[model samples]
Structure formats: structure tokens, C-alpha cells
Target chain A: MLEIATPFVKKAGEAYLLVLQRSSEFETYTPAVNSARELLVKMDPQAVPYEKGQLGIEYHRVDWMGLSL
Target chain B: MKIILGILLVLGVSCSSTNQKVESTATTDETEIQAPAEPLKKRKTKKQKSAVVTPPQEESEPLAEEKREDPYLGVKEAIKNANWQGLEGEAQKILEQNNQNIIALNALGMAHFYQGRPLAAKYFLNKALSINPNSSDVKNNLAYVTKKEGRSRQAIILWRQVATAGGSSSKIAYENLINEFTIAKDYKKVVGAADSLGSQNVTSVATLNSLALAAIVKSEFDEAEKLLNQALEKENNNEALLINMAILQLDFKKNLDQGRRYLDRISFLGVQSNRRDIVTRLEAVAQSLTNQGEVK
Candidate 1:
């Protein structure tokens, strides 16, 4: 799986993340990818598995008032 | 800003209290003379003999009356009414009598300035400043005259001096500096000048726009974004600000999604008639971004 981390909702008026997934180009997953997966699962307990050929994260909010991601 | 500074100079000299007594004395003398005019008599013999002599006396009487009348009164009236021609004559008259009169010198400078004689304006304004080097009013006028004369570097120096002089004059100077720097394409200085005004003084949409443009010119995308965002906070529905933000995102930051988001906001805000071009440009940028993504 190809995991992408992008900013989601504000965490105390700062950037907080939501992880998304799609098909991976790599033949084998690295330790960093594994660790990110574990972190994402811990961050969002109800994480769903990636479907084949699905698009990655396509949306993020820009906090215009505070100018945070 | 230049127009406002010019108006302030005119009003400043017009309202000066230093020479009111001189003007009042002249007016009182004229009133005393006019208060004792004899009625015209019906004498045909006296009329023929007096007619020849009266022509010369009548001709010279106006010149004497003009000399005796308070030049400052005419200067004040002309300035109040925005009659540049009348101001030129009255100011010239005052200067002829006393070249050291700072008020008359200022008036003469402003009269030439309003009449589109920048060189003449500079001459008289320089004379005034020579006499009273600390007069912020004269300095401001000289700066504008210098700008009009195409000596923007000198004008910028004078404006900076006036800006440091403080008060409403400083505000005018800041505005003039912004404009001159913009024309000079010295965007770095523009940003510096705007920042020096501090947040409270730099709250206007125009100033914000200038700061943003300056940042953009320097290719400082983050600073541009901050300034644009601050301006947007003040005028969220302003189409120009929306368009600027959209362009900044798409062209400079290369953030297609953010650009599209701003474009969506602009469309929802209802594009003004004059802003149709910006909308068209945004749409073209969005299309180009989509095409680029497809190519990738």
C-alpha cells in the first residue's frame, strides 16, 4: 500500500493529520512505511484497509483565519 | 496621496494666524477710505474737463488699490476656492513685497504646483524650506514637486524625512513612498516602508495589497500569502483579493487544489463585471493544472 499523510482538522489551532492509502509502486514495504502504518492505526483506531487502485487523500482544510494547514 | 498632501499645504498656508493682523490692517484702511465716498454731481462742464484727467487717475487707481489690498487675503480666498490663477498673482504680489514671507513662499509654490509648473513649484518651495528648514509642510510640497519633476530618488528621500516627522504628515509620506517605490519596482523598500508603519497604521486594504504585491515581486511566497490572508480577513468578499490569492496559490505556490478552492469561493461570491477577466484567468489556470496532472 502507498500511504500518504496530509493535514486534517485543527489540533489546538495547528496542523493535525489523517492518513490515506492507495496502490503502492514499491515491490516491498519498508520499515518506515510499517512504522507509519502503526502510527496511523494508533492515531485513528477505526482505520480502513486500502482498496486496489484507490486514490490517496484528495482533500485538506486550510485554516485561513490562523493560516495553518 | 499627493493630491491630499497638496490640499493640506494649501489649507495650511491659508489658515496661518501669523499674518492675520497685517491683512486686517489693510482691510480696515480700505474700509475707512471707502466709507467716505462723495456722491457724483451732474456737471457737464466739469465732466468734459475731468474726463481726460479722470481716465489716467482711474487707470492708476486700480494699480494703487491692488498694491494697497492685502495680498494674503487674495491668497487665502484663491486657495479656499481652488483658483490657481488668482493664487499665483496674489502669492507673487506678497513675494514681491517681502521675499522672506514663508507663508507667501509656500502659497506661491502650491500655486505653481496646482497649475502644473513643478519646476517653479520646486524653486519657491526650496526658498521656503531654506528660510524654515523644519517646516514639514514645505518638505511635503517639495517632495511632491520633485516627484512631478521626475526626480523620484530625491522625492523618496524627502518623503522619508516627512514620514519621520510624524503625525498626519507621516501617513501621507508613507503613502507617497509606497507609490513611488511601486513605480520604481523597488518592492523590497516598499515592504520595508509598509512594515515600518506597524500593524495599526498598516491596516488599510490598499497598504495590505501593496505589501502583498511587494512580497510577490520578491518571490517570497510565504510572506505574500500571510499579507494576502490578512487583507482577506478584512475584506473577505473583495474579488481582487480573492483573485490575488488564487493567482498566488496557482502560479507561485503551484498549489492547484488551494487555487481551485479560492476560485470556487470567488465564483460563489459573484464575480463583479470588472473582475470577469480575473475569473477567466483563474479558470484557464485551473484547466492548465488539470492538464498537467493528467500529463503526469
Candidate 2:
């Protein structure tokens, strides 16, 4: 399952959205991440994309994904 | 010598006739004067009766005039013209005749209020209210005095009563009540009062903004938006309405992009120093969120 969260911040009377995407496999996550980026860009062409580490969130890889097959 | 004697005799006869004519004319003049004096003495007794009777009649004529024309008319006109000194004088004249005249009392109170004498205004207005407890004009004036004196709670109650009285002055009374409630930060009462005035009837931008603020505090986002929209329709570029809309979008609806659009509009419209600071801070937060991305 892929989980996506967008948190909003206010600065100088403007609101900005921060998008985060998480999944078990990088290959499986890529589509969801790209879709979310496309949606944010559609909403605001100037919206910048960033990783979870940039916002101080730890990134963890799922060990079970590599063990399967 | 004979001719000179005849001429002297003729002259002496002419002088004697002229003297007799002068004496007769003086006697006729004295008789005419005496004749009028006797009648004047006789009429003097009748004149005394009229002198006594005319005083009471003359006294009541002005009192009757006072009753018919309204003694306070001059005072009212003076107040309308912003002639404060003239208003005071006219009101004092009415009060001198009847101490309990409510119109005079109200006029005096208003004159004092305009002159920045709140205490005196309150005293006169209170007295006027005492004379006629149901007089909305007196009550409204007293409420203004109380408001000026910073007794906002009491002023609110009096204004509410005046509004409830329902007369020519009710609309003004309701407006005053809404204003006082807003200033006192009694948002609940402000909402109730504004609602009582009816949404269609609420034309004042300040009242609408107060109602919107009250709705926001209660978390009634839809109502707040509707009221803000109504006010914006009247004043399209109202800075206060724009700011409130931005807050509603960002804080309540969680729509960052929508909120940013509102902020942009506010910047384009221009803001005061204090509001500019607030907008700058909000924009900084938005930019930080944009840079940091979404937190998981």
C-alpha cells in the first residue's frame, strides 16, 4: 500500500503545500510519487518537491519486500 | 390836531376789541381741558378693573402658546443645526417653565454630550427617563452617555431596550447596540443582535464583519463565509474581509493554494503596516511548508 500526505505551511500570507509519499518498493512507489508531484504541480506550477528527510522525517526501507521471491 | 385825535380814538377801539377776543379764546380752551379731565377721572375707576383682569389673561396666553407649539421646538432645531449653546439655552428655558419636560431634558443631555460633558449628559438624560420611563429618545441619549462614560454593559442593555421599543429610532438603536456589543467582545450577543436585525437588513460592514467573526469563533465556517461574502459584495476590496477570507481558507478549510490566492489579492490591494506584518509572517510559514514538503 502507498501512503501520501500533504502538509500545508503559511508564510508571508501565502500557503504552501508539502507532499510526502511512502511505499514498500521503490518501483511501486515511483508511480504514486510521480502522480502526487504532477497533481501538486498542476495545482501550482511553482510548487517545489522535497523528500521526507528534508522535513526531518526518517526514511525506512521494508526488509520483507526484498525477501519475497 | 382834530385829525390826529380821531385816528387815536379809532386805534384805541380796535385794541380793546382784540383784548376781548383773546380773553374769550383763553376761556374756551380752559373749558375744553376741564371737560376731558372730569371724564378721565370717571374712566379711571373702570381702568383699574381692566388692569387687574389683564394680568391673568396675559399670563395664560403664553402658557397656551407653550402647549400648542411645543416649547422644545427651538431646542430641537438648535440641536439639529449643531448650535450647542443655543440648544442649551432653549432647553434651559423649557426646564425653567417645567422642570420635568422630557424633550427639554433630552435636548440638554444631547447638548452636554456633544460638548464632551458625559457626566452632565448622563444626569439630565437619567432625569428625563425618570419623568417618562418609556421615552425611547431619552433612553437612547442616556445610553450614548453611558457608552461615552465607558459603562458599556449598561449602555448595551439600554440600547437593547431602545431597539426593542420599535419606533422611528429603533434602527439607530439596534445599530448602536451591535456596535457596543462588538466593542465589548461579547461575540455571542453580537451574533444574536445582528441576527435579530435580519441578514437582509444588516447593511453595515462593521456589523457584518462582527457577525462573521462570531461565526468563525463558533466554528460555523459556512456562516462566516456567507457573511464575509455579503460584506465583500458591498466593499469588494475590503482589507478586513480579505484577511478573514484568507484565515478561513488556510486555518479552517485547510486549502493552502486557495489561502495563498487570497493573500496575493490582499497584497495587490495594499495593507497597513500592522496588516502587512501579519501577511508577511503568514507567507513565510507557507514558504517553509513548501520547502519542507509533506511530513509523514
Encode model 2's per-residue lDDT on B1-296: one tens digit a residue: 99999999999999999999999999989877777757775556556656756575578899999867865567656755778888889889988999987777787777787788888888888898788888887777677777666565666677778788888566667767665555443445656776667556767776677667667666787897898899889988878778777777665656678778888998998987856755775677567555655652
Q: Superposing all C-alpha atoms, what RMSD in Å does each candidate have to the true structure?
A: 26.0, 24.1
Model 2, stretches more than 4 Å misplaced?
A1-69, B1-104, B160-174, B218-223, B229-239, B253-277, B284-296
Q: List the candidate 1 regions with Cα displacement exceeding 4 Å.
A: A1-69, B1-83, B86-104, B165-168, B199-208, B214-246, B252-284, B291-296
Candidate 1: lDDT of B18?
Answer: 47
> What does candidate 1 score on TM?
0.42
Give native contacts recovered, as a fraction, per prediction. 0.00, 0.00
What is residue B5's positional error in candidate 2, in angstroms?
A: 99
Model 1 per-residue lDDT tens digits across residues B190-236: 66776666535566665666667666766777987897899789988
Q: What pairs collide in candidate 1?
A: none
